[model samples]
Target: MTLSFFDQFMSPVLMGIPLMFLALTLPWALFAKPSPRVLNSRMVALQTWSIMGFVKQIFQPLSTPAHKWAMILTSVMMFIITMNLLGLLPYTFTPTTQLSLNLGLAVPLWLATVILGMRNQPTHALGHLLPEGTPPLLIPLLIIIETISLFIRPLALGVRLTANLTAGHLLIQLISTAAFTLISIMPTVAFLTGLLLFLLTFLEVAVAMIQAYVFVLLLSLYLQENV
Candidate 1:
């Protein structure tokens, strides 16, 4: 039976049990646990330093109130980046490529930011729906438009991630197949295609990391507006 290119996205199973949970939880265990000693092992120290740097850069533009989310946001970025990079490996499924998973992640977080804004600064949050200098004729239309945009933020977040990863994975599969098929017929052409595939793999690696960062960064921007 010929497998479809899209089959790669399917969650794998072992004896009828889904492995998605295992994939999701596996990344956390891969990290080094901190030691009680004054100096950590190299792995632990490197992990700590990288995390600190990531958090600082993400929160650089935000006010003190937003610093409270440093742990949550940083943890999310780490989780997502790990999952994305791991998905690029052979025979692995990418959970983030699914709209349901992405939406599950995005909606609650985006809603939290909006709800926080509504709770702590009701007027300021509501005011975002309408500009201060709106013309009398355009006020209603502008408010409607802004409201739609506000609600669409989460959907955009989920779709943007799902689409980017899905497209990249599909392209990789297609190119690799072409290279494999050409191997016996035209060795030189197949070699060139294989080289192209190698370069694309590196590009996808960068994309995986960037998409994860962009996902977190957009959420932080949403939070910035609220807090």
Candidate 2:
């Protein structure tokens, strides 16, 4: 049987049951729960400290009104990070690589921010469509352009995440396959390729984490503009 490179992006199935649900739920189980003890284990302590730092960094620039979204944003950050990292393991599927899944996550959050802004401060939200001191002739054109850009935000968010993860995974798979194929044909070349593959894998790990952070950071910026 011949396998296609794109096969890696497809959600797996077993006995007619899709595994995406399992992939989504498994990451929550790996999270460390806080202990009530005065001194928790080192792992829990580190996790707490890291999470606090992330929250602080994300919310620092936003007004008090935006702070209420801290929990939702934080949970999303953790979820994306976990899913991205998990997908790097052998035989694991990456849900974020799917455009549909990414769009599903991005649209509602982006729409909510937009809706919140419109509801709370309609004047300000609508004002964004027109810049101060614009020529009367350009008003219609600018408003049309701005409106299009506003709606494109969610699509851009989803595509950015899907493209990054999909590209990284595809590259890793291609390079590893090349390394394996060269092993018997040329030992020295194969060894060099293998070393390159190792480096690529490490880089992919970083990419996975960074992409997750970027996704969350952009969403927070959107929220900041709204709140």
Candidate 3:
């Protein structure tokens, strides 16, 4: 299983999507942790009238708004961490390991910040994008970088997950593949190599939680800052 440079780049990239985790989520409620969430006016209206029960169905029977949001976000963190752990298995999909999926989670927070700021103070949201304590002379450069970075957080979110997970998966896969290939030729020597993959996978679950926590924590901080 010694791969050339080309093979090194090819294997898991072919499986960009995480199929197994998505399949496991099919009976969504089994994987879902339902809880109380507050009903905003818009959601209240939907709960009262929507045919699909889209508004309140995911929520617990007597949930408040915070309960529901808490459930939703916690479920997402679990989903990502679970998926990442699953991917570490011999053959499984890691949804959070994808750039697209991570961006899907991050971009909405960015959009929400914009909407929250605008709604709170229609004329002032854009102004809040710049640093508050900077000197007037340094204002332009600070504004440019901060604004650009603000916009790029979602992209950073995506890249951060994609890069780290992809690198870990690639390294582990390469190591295991090498061991598997040589195990027949040199049984005793490759056993340790094969075992290392499992140890690393166990370690990766922690990495998954850390990354998810970092994403959500930054999101909460950003929301607090803007809104």
Candidate 4:
């Protein structure tokens, strides 16, 4: 029974074929594309305005060179937000809940910033490994520590997103199970539990949006340092 609770996180399969690809593509369909005509529908207008705001905020701190990444960053942010929110609906699979998927997204973007730094300003990039005016004895230790931290960034990014979403989903499921079980035996308690569940669902919605923003914000910060 306990294992069944975790089964929701597993990629759904049909005839032995994993449907993760479908889950990944499903969220994109919900977003309305902009129209070429002069006037646009309210849905398209809202999407356009919100995306513009996010793009402006993300690029505000980044250099001109990093501005080239605006489209990619915005798309990823929207994708993650959509996936996280969609998972809250009945029978929907969240691609972001998978650590492998999160890591796949994180590693490439982090590596891109690192590579950009190295290619554009090798000296500046390497300088991040050791601080200036370091004592000779501490130089080697600091360099090793910084290097380790540098590589760990992607891992941290992946783990953070996975852990938060997984924990929230587990809690929601647990609370829901309790609510359903109590509905007959203890009507009052079940009603309160249902109320709590509703509130938790709202909080999770905010978390879904916040986590996506945080993920993109951190990536932009990394880009800022490189550019």
Per-residue CA lDDT of model 1 for 143-172, tens digit only, reads: 999999999999999999999999999999
List TM-scores for all candidates, in order: 0.97, 0.97, 0.67, 0.97
RMSD of each: 1.1, 0.9, 9.4, 1.1
lDDT of 3 at 168: 80
Off by over 4 Å in 1: none
Model 4 lDDT at residue 23: 90
Per-residue CA lDDT of model 4 for 93-135, tens digit only, reads 8888999999999999999999999999999999999999999
Q: Between candidates 1 and 3, name the one with more favorable TM-score.
A: 1
CA lDDT of every candidate: 0.94, 0.91, 0.63, 0.94
- A best-first ranking of the candidates according to their TM-score comes to 2, 4, 1, 3
| Native-referenced Cα lDDT, model 2 | 0.91
Candidate with more favorable, higher lDDT: 2 or 4: 4
Write the residue-wise lDDT of candidate 3 on 77-149 in tens digits. Answer: 5556666665666545566665666788889866776677678766676776675788999899888887897
